[model samples]
Target: MHFDLADLRLFVHIAESPSLTQGARRAHLSAAAASARIKALESQLDSRLLYRDNRGVELTPSGQRLLQHARLILRQVERLKDDFSEQGGDQAGHIRIFANTTAVTEFLPEVLAGFLAARPAVTVDLQERLNRDIVRAILDGSADLGIVAGPVRAEGLEILHFSTDHLVLAVPPGHALERLGRPPTLADTLGYFHVGLHEGSTLQSFLREQVERLGGTLNLRIQVASFEAACRMIEAGVGIGVLPETAARRHQRSMGLSILQLDEPWVVRERSVLVREREALPGCARTLVELLRQVGDGVVAP
Candidate 1:
């Protein structure tokens, strides 16, 4: 029996999305079209693939097993396209990249802009996630590459050094932090409302771990997906936030956010890039990865 790649891709989208409606939108299909596709897929497999509920659809046992093979098959198809593209005809295929918040906001903007300029035919699907989640994505063939900060155990992946970044506390003007008359430690500021990065972000997770060690915890008033949003939260006096030094200072003047010094040694961290395997990466992915490593000054590489 032959399987349709369109159905498999749509199934993957539905599996990852919060709802069938949203998944259909992502796949650019009308709800009726998506339902028909899923029904055909189920009929072809002769098993139920998803369980629809009020909250959303969940994978049935058959779907759970099929998801694994679907991801692998789709990945192979993408590699084939990239292989052909690299043979010199017009380039094609997409690259899915997962990166941490700091790299997403601070580093990748310029890096990706340059890569896209040179290879206009290639598409990059980028997502922000914590290092741990990025690890899972790369291992499962769901993501082509990942850029994350802090230590990660990537057993089956090829790793390379990316960059280093420092985390600094951002507070609003006239906040109590200003009256402290000196640099405050992370623990010193844990008592107040704070803004934070996404729940799975490395910096945010690391900050939470640090606070727990100090017999305190973060009292986040809000959680934002980007550093700019966190800066906005601080600017409104909604809460204090920890941010990358470069990002904090970049908007310090314009956003009226203050950077508070942290004396903690672990506040500085290094980033690394993870891929399934260097040799196995497709042509477009290889090109983008090399550009990422070589763009800055030939320093970031294993």
Candidate 2:
């Protein structure tokens, strides 16, 4: 049977989108054209791929099965592109690295710098995402590698222990919580306004979940995108903030922000690097993973 990549790509897009119209737009096809293509594909396959109605299309069992393989095939196609881009044996390829705020902020820069210096022909595209989102991107074939700030399901991925990240609450020096010498439980501070990361951030999600577990609700005063922003908001006396230890120390001595140890075991976050399986990574991406794995490359001790 002849399989068309274009049809498969459109099918994947349609399956992901809320409506066939939206998916066709994303694929740069007119609704009529896209509909025609899908009809032809269904005829060729002798199966219904979608249940179409006014609202949207739902994937049939056959469409669902095809989506799984389509994603894998497209991922392999991207791999082929990266693997073939070369210049005189000096690896020339693009690697996409998706990481959570902690790994992106504290760990990856220096490591990536050294790797890029050695492999000058390789290009790195780094993006910051929440930890679980990073895992999803990797599993869905959208990202070549991922660095997440905690353990996640590793069903089909190769894992690398990257670093240890400890979180502490940052408060303005004279804040009410600062008067107490003992570490504060999350419940103790739920009454105060908080400087939180972005709403959908992994750290923010964890904090919110913990607050819920403690039978309290988060009262966020402001939401910023990074630890630096949160620290700055804290320094401005806006509200208390949770930050990585690396950031807290760097800012504490200068910003005069007081670091309060979190009285919870989960505050110490473990970071890990994940890939589609070590061998599946292209040469350029694999090299970077090796650099992360190298013991002496400042891999923080547990």
After superposing candidate 2 on the true structure, give the runs of residues whose Cα lies further than 4 Å from its correct spot: 10-36, 50-61, 80-85, 88-90, 94-97, 104-130, 294-302
Expressed as tens digits, the lDDT of each residue in 1-302 for candidate 2 is 88899999999889879999999998999999999999999999999999999889999999987887887787677567766664522366778889877767666787777777777778888988877778877787767899887668878787788567788889998888877778987877888999998877778888888888887889999999778788889999999987888888987776868889989978887777888877767777776777776633465321
**In candidate 1, how many Å is residue 65 off?**
2.3
* Candidate 1 to truth, TM: 0.79
| Best prediction by lDDT | 1
TM-scores for all predictions: 0.79, 0.79
**On residues 163-206, what C-alpha lDDT tens digit does candidate 1 reach at each position?**
67778888998888878888789888888999998777768887
Task: Give the clash total for candidate 1.
Answer: 0
Give the per-residue Cα lDDT of candidate 2 at 179.
73
| Candidate-wise lDDT, in order | 0.83, 0.81
